[model samples]
Target: MASTTAFIDVPESPDRIWQLIGGFGSLPDWLPYIPESELSEGGRVRRLTNQDGGVIVERLQAFDHTARSYSYAIEQAPFPVTGYLSTLSVHPVPGQTAAARVEWSGSFTPVGVSDADAEELFHGIYTDGLAALLKTAQGWRG
Candidate 1:
């Protein structure tokens, strides 16, 4: 039941930013955390090669374009965790001129003897990823 969330303000339309992050196959292009990602529904696995050369393979649980969100579980992650799910959403910020809100969150269960540290780990994971993504997208907006 652990969870974490992050927000990013991008100076662009929500759809424009979504067009970049929603591609589902361009994570490695901007986010250093994911060296590569192969996206699909239900069984498509996300293969992430971390900066430390560690590999994590997550199973795609759900992806809904209308809701502008996706979820995945750690099928065989290098981390000491299980039952993981990461999700993201985009929204227009009220009263913010040409600004949008990017919300990212996730959680996971501890594996075996490791303390349930998935939520703690994902806090930085999602936050940092969004920062990089917004930075990359905003550069193109101008």
Candidate 2:
């Protein structure tokens, strides 16, 4: 399995960052490719309006507030892939740092793609996606 990790530093508290990333349904606001996303746990699901004007679904595998981390997988990711496990985490930097950085890492098995190509695709997806999201998210003061 190949994996990619990307991080974004936001000028906000961990709580604020968590409030955003934790709300899986709001991912489309920053994550470009995913125009819409939803999170379901227990019996409720929060849906986000997708970038495609449609919708994307997600299932929360695990969420731990106190630990500042969560894991999820796309129900219908619009990609040539399967078994995608995505995880995000937030935490305070060193001392007196009022900023929070969001980092994510995940990997999946290629469906009709070669391992080398899949690896390269995912690498670009994760890094570029994270950078863009970080920029957009930081600009969002609301």
Candidate 3:
């Protein structure tokens, strides 16, 4: 399995950030690449439609409101990945007052793709997604 991780520091409370990130069907609200998302299975699953007509079905595996973290597994995706799982978490920046940290991490095995390509793909997604999340979170405070 290959893993990728991305982290961003923001001037917001951890609880505030978690409220945005923990929304299972809020991808399109912040992610520019995701044009639409449909929630099913009583909001436990989300079907994300990409701008390029690609689709990914993800299921919420675990969520902890108190911990400010959530984990999801990709049931179907456009890429050749297996056992794809991702976790998004918000943490307080110790001694930073209201500052917080957001983390995006995923692990998956490439079915028929090169490890390097898979790594690059995951990294790019996390990098862009986290940047947009930070932007949205900042706007929430304004």
Candidate 4:
């Protein structure tokens, strides 16, 4: 399986960051490429529409507010991937009262694409997502 992980430091409390991104259907709020999101299955499923008109459906596998983390599996996506599982987590930095680290990681098998290309695609997506989250967190702080 190809895997990708990305991290970003945000000037916000871990709890605050979790409050911003913890919801299963909150991608459209911080993910720049996501234009909108809809939740169903009693908030266990999320459908995200991207800026390029691509749609991805994901199912929440796990969530822990106290742990500040969540995991999801992709049910449908535009990418050439299968068995995709991803986790997003927030951790408060030690000794940093108002700083936190956010991580997004995913593992999947490439379907019709090269493994390297698939890894690159996911890495780019995570990088863009983390950057957007950091920017928004900064704006909230400002």
Candidate 5:
């Protein structure tokens, strides 16, 4: 399996960051590429609509609200990977009461692609997503 992890430190508390992104179906709230999300299967599955109108279906695999972390697996998507499992988490930055670290990590088997290429793709996605999240959080009043 191939894996990639991307993280960003934002000027926000861990609790605030978690409140923004801890939900299983909250991608649209922080990730601009995902403009819409629909939850099904009693909120265990999420159908996301990308900016290009592509549909991506994912199932929540695990969640730990106390830890401010959640994991999900892709059920259907246009990416050239399978068995995709990803986790998003918020962590407190030691000695930084107004700062937090947000991590996006994933592992998957490449399909019709090299492992390097797959990693690059996901790393870019995670990087861009975190940047957007930072922007959104910066604009948030609470």
Candidate 6:
């Protein structure tokens, strides 16, 4: 399996960051690329609509609200990978009560692509998503 992890430090408390992104279907709230999300299967699955109107369905694999982390697996998507499992977490930065670290990591089997290419694709996605999350969190009040 190939994997990639991306992270960003934001000037927000871990609780605040988790409040923004801890939900299984909260991607649209922080990730601009995903404009819409609908939950099904009693909130265990999410159907996301991208900016380009592409549909991506995912199933929740695990969640730990106390830890501010969640893991999910792609059920259907246009990505060139399979068995995709991803986790997103918020961690408190030591000595920085007002700051938090957000990490996004994924592992998958490449399909019709090299491991490097797959890693690059997800790394870019995670990095860009985190940047967007930072922007959203910064502008968030409450």
In model 2, residue pairs whose N, Cα or C atoms come closer than 3 Å (at least 3 residues apart or on different chains), thus clashing, are 35-50, 35-51, 36-50
- Per-residue lDDT of 64-97 in model 6, one digit per residue for the tens? 9999999999999999999999999999988887
Candidate 2, residue 42: the lDDT equals 52
Runs of candidate 3 exceeding 4 Å displacement: none
Clashing pairs in 3: none
Score candidate 3 by TM-score against the native.
Answer: 0.93
RMSD (CA, Å), each prediction: 2.6, 3.0, 1.3, 1.0, 1.2, 1.3
Per-residue CA lDDT of candidate 5, range 2-104, in tens? Answer: 9999999999899989999998888899899999999999999999999999999999999999999999999999999999999999999888989999999
Residue 46, candidate 4: Cα error in Å is: 0.4
Total clashing pairs for each candidate: 0, 3, 0, 0, 0, 0
Q: Which pairs of residues clash in candidate 4, taking residues 3 or more apart in a chain or in different chains?
A: none
Instruction: After superposing candidate 4 on the true structure, give the runs of residues whose Cα lies further than 4 Å from its correct spot.
Output: none
Tens digits of per-residue lDDT for model 3 on 10-124?
8988887777777989888788899899999999999999999998999999998888888999998888799999999889998897978989999999888987889889999
Off by more than 4 A, model 1: 39-43, 112-117
lDDT of 3 at 51: 93
| Candidate 6 TM-score versus the reference | 0.97
Model 2 agreement with the true structure over 1-142: per-residue lDDT tens digits: 5567777677778887787767556666667777755555652354545556765466777889887888877667566678878788887865647788778888778789876777777778777776876677668765
Worst ten in a row by lDDT for model 6: 133-142
What TM-score would each prediction reach against the true structure? Answer: 0.82, 0.75, 0.93, 0.96, 0.97, 0.97
Deviation of model 4 at 20, angstroms: 0.5
All candidates' lDDT scores? 0.73, 0.71, 0.89, 0.92, 0.95, 0.95
Measured on C-alpha atoms, candidate 6 has an lDDT of 0.95
lDDT of 4 by residue, 1-142 (tens): 8998999989888989998899988888888889799999999999998998888999999999899999999999888999999999999988899999999999999998988999999999899899999989989857
